[model samples]
Target chain A: MERPTLDQIWAWLDQIPDPEIPVISLVDLGVIRDALWKGDTLHLKVTPTYSGCPATAVINLDIQQHLRANGIDKLVLERQLSPAWTTDWISEKGRRNLQKFGIAPPPKDGEHGSYGALLGRVVECPRCGSKTTERISQFGSTPCKASYRCTECLEPFDYFKCI
Target chain B: MADKALFEFLTRIGDTTLVLGHRVSEWCGHAPALEEDIALANTALDLIGHTRMWLSRAGEVEGKGRTEDDLAFLREAHEFRNYLLVERPNEDFAVTITRQFLFDAWHRLMLISLQESSDQRVSEIAEKASKEVAYHVERSTDLVVRLGDGTEESHRRMQHAVDILWPYTGELFTDDETDRELSDRGIIPLPSSLEGEWKTHVDGVLSAATLVRPEREYAHKGGKAGVHTEHLGFLLAEMQVTHRAHPGATW
Candidate 1:
């Protein structure tokens, strides 16, 4: 069989959506750090969005099933922790997709402090595009998101909180 | 000696988080409000997540085939190395918040100093951990201030929580041989060195909360050398029952 190039592997990997957030691909989520061919085996590096993310295992299994389906059997997935995954790595496309899915994406500049939520900074609601949203809680249904309610739209939404 | 020290250091943080995480999870359905409940559960998740990183490193340093699961689930109470503060039962909402506030304050300082560790692995883990912990500290502080300044009953409970937990804070800064070795090797900060910053941060929060600091500087010790409070055994029994009964069992 002809070997799949790194680019081809990444494209295949991108086909896998984030386990919790289905709207965005794992590649767009930036957890798929790198992929390279080590002779016959494909070496892939992934980082978790949060240390205790329940989706970490599911994401790994999904990746394995994904690459295997693509006919690249020799594979190794390494959980890289040094750089640590940050919301900053979410691709521009991923942000747009998250917003379209009714979840507010994190700001691009990431200037928001860890205590940014306490300061009453505006998180524009994905639904109405209103800048009048208030955080309902620091946590949401998953570890990576915060709950916000828009006064203008009267809708509760998830904010991909900056870590 | 170095690997032994590293294992000791890692397990100290690892086991502490494991115990506290489990305790926090106990509040899943029972917290004061639904939002607080979800917040506690997520906090527990983050702590357990950190437990994996620290215990994984400990297992590597020990060079044993034991995984993070083994380190977390298989160890007897005496074999555990977490501080006494974390193992205490979550007596009430105030105590839980106060306990979290104290630990988060110290934990933040510890992780910050660790970011400069001579060991890159240590620094990297600390760097990543520091970000998550920033959120923990902020939330706990807000709760403490709110409850402390809120009402007569809440104010009394918050103050009582602080008074009761204050003694344990000293043990957090007490340095021993394992700490001395790690600090000497530049792999971690000396526990005593972090005390100043911890106190400063805690003092600021306590003042803002209108809670007074306990005058006593005396502290209970011995968690570092494997000695632990009786509370740990019960907590462990509940936590380990599932794992022990079904060795290597997975859903």
Candidate 2:
């Protein structure tokens, strides 16, 4: 068997969708920090979106299984917590997918300034793109999201909260 | 020199969050509203997530060939070290809100202090946990104010909750030899140092909520030293039951 290059491994990882948000690949979601070759074994650094995100374990398993299925059997997945995962890491491609899937992608960090960032207070409706939205709760169905309601559309949606 | 103290200190926080996380999890389906149910569960997951990191670190420090699971599931109640304040039951929504508000205040302060820890592991975990806890404090503080200043019934319940829990809060600020050594090494903050800020924060919240601060001087102590109230045993029973029953079971 031939050893896959790091770029090749990343391409494989990019095929793996986030288990919870199946629209975006793990690479675009930014949880897959880095993939490297250490001897015959492949070592990858993965950071969780939320420290307590239940999907973290599934994501790890999916990465391992997907890589193994691709003929790369030796794998090591490391959990990286420092410089924690922020919605800032979600790629432009991933953000579009989230919006297309009826979830408001988080407002970019400096877009809101420190005041809005501190409160995470501004959000546009993912459904109607209306600026008038009120937070339903700081929590949603998942750890990485917050529940919100669009005043214009009257439709409730999830916001991928910025860390 | 501080390895033993560090291990004990890690267990103290690990178990505190674990017990509190379990107690919060009990509100999963039973919260007063659907949004609250989701919110409570989310908070529980975050706390438990922090618990995994803390306990795993504790196991590493102890070097006893124990993993986080071993430390969390195998320990008897007597072997556990957590705060007595965390073990208090969630009597009702008001009580739960009150307890979370109190703990989150101290937790926030402690984490902020710890983000500066000289230990790389400690500081890194603290840096990550600090962000999540920032949200916890915001949510808990908002609720404490709302419930405290709400209608008579809610106000009464919130007041009762605060008064009952006030005594246990004292234990969090009392420092001992472990705290002394750790602070000397710049690994962790002296618990007492956090009290001033905790009080100022809690006071502002209580004021906004229209709740009076308790004047009680007698404080319940000893959860740090592994002395616990009766509530912890039941929590551990339910928490550890699955692990004990299946022993090394994995999905």
Q: Which ten residues in a row have the lowest lDDT in candidate 1 chain A?
A: A111-120
Over 4 Å off, model 2:
A110-116
Q: How many Å off is the CA of A20 in candidate 2?
A: 0.4
Q: Model 2's DockQ?
A: 0.59
List of clashing residue pairs for candidate 1: none
Sum up the clashes in candidate 1. 0
Model 2 lDDT per residue over B5-77, tens place: 9999999999989999999999988999999999999999999999999999998899887888899899988
Candidate 2 docking category?
A: medium
- Model 2, residue B4: displacement in angstroms? 0.8
- By DockQ, the best candidate is 1
Candidate 1 per-residue lDDT, tens place, A109-140, comes to 66533544436567999999999878778888
